[model samples]
Target: GAGVSQSPSNKVTEKGKDVELRCDPISGHTALYWYRQSLGQGLEFLIYFQGNSAPDKSGLPSDRFSAERTGGSVSTLTIQRTQQEDSAVYLCASSLASSGAQHFGDGTRLSIL
Candidate 1:
């Protein structure tokens, strides 16, 4: 992908349903990150992956949230039993290295009804 690409730019789901969001990072980038931004709230880091290392899942809100990166490239985030509080913009970003600035995608707007 040129920059980062995320699927289903807008998603509307009923409460308790599950939703999966996808992200394709830029070529050759080694670090990928997922973040969530709620209305009037700052971006919150959800997870981070660098190469074959263990993913940093420190910021996932609950047990229902999970993610995985394949081949050190594309990534997917799944939210199970979605709640109204889950409505937010999920953003994906990638960097050449963990210490570099990240390039962000437009984000997936998930709305739990």
Candidate 2:
């Protein structure tokens, strides 16, 4: 029962650079979601994936943001061209199903310099 785990709990990168954040979901969970919480702002949904279905990318802020889940267990979020405005805590969560209550990870705090 390894819950969910995220890497580089804190990351500082220069603007315009690319950064990849990783997430490991709990075993047997088929729903995974990504969200971003900016300083003093509410959580914004980024993307969601369930089983082998097409990912819901409607919430992705821009083309610069993308994510992929492999084997329905691990996921990675990639920012192609980082910007100061993109600095936020990238949270990953998972649940038994898309509509179930999600368990959240501490998140990878990305800071664009």
Candidate 3:
């Protein structure tokens, strides 16, 4: 796809399980971001990756959440020991540069049981 792509559009899992969400950004985009949107809530930044610089993970809510962008392209967000509160739509976006406009994916909806 020419735009950002996220896998497993919907995920339903037990509360205690772990889940991995994948994001493939637009080719040649040097900046990628991960965000979460809960029901009726605005998007919350989770992580950011710009080129080879260290990823900005300060937005992550807890240690259980982590993400990584590999080879400056595909990125993955992993949630360990999922909880009901973790349920939300995970959105992926990419831009030509950190300050450029970003293109977003449809997002992956996660449901915790």
Candidates' lDDT values, in order?
0.95, 0.93, 0.94
* Candidate 1 deviant stretches above 4 angstroms: none
The deviation in Å at residue 55 for candidate 2 is 0.4
Candidate 2's C-alpha runs over 4 A off are none
| TM-score for all models, in order of appearance | 0.96, 0.95, 0.96
Q: Candidate 2 overall Cα lDDT vs. reference?
A: 0.93
User: Residue 16 lDDT in model 1?
Assistant: 98
Clashing pairs in 1: none
Report the Cα lDDT for residue 91, model 2.
98
Query: Which sections of candidate 3 miss by over 4 Å?
Result: none
lDDT of 1 by residue, 1-113 (tens): 48899998999999999999999999999999999999777899999999999999999999999999988899999999999999999999999884578999999999989
RMSD of each: 1.0, 1.2, 1.0
Task: Give the distance in Å from residue 31's predicted Cα in candidate 2 to where it truly belongs.
Answer: 0.4
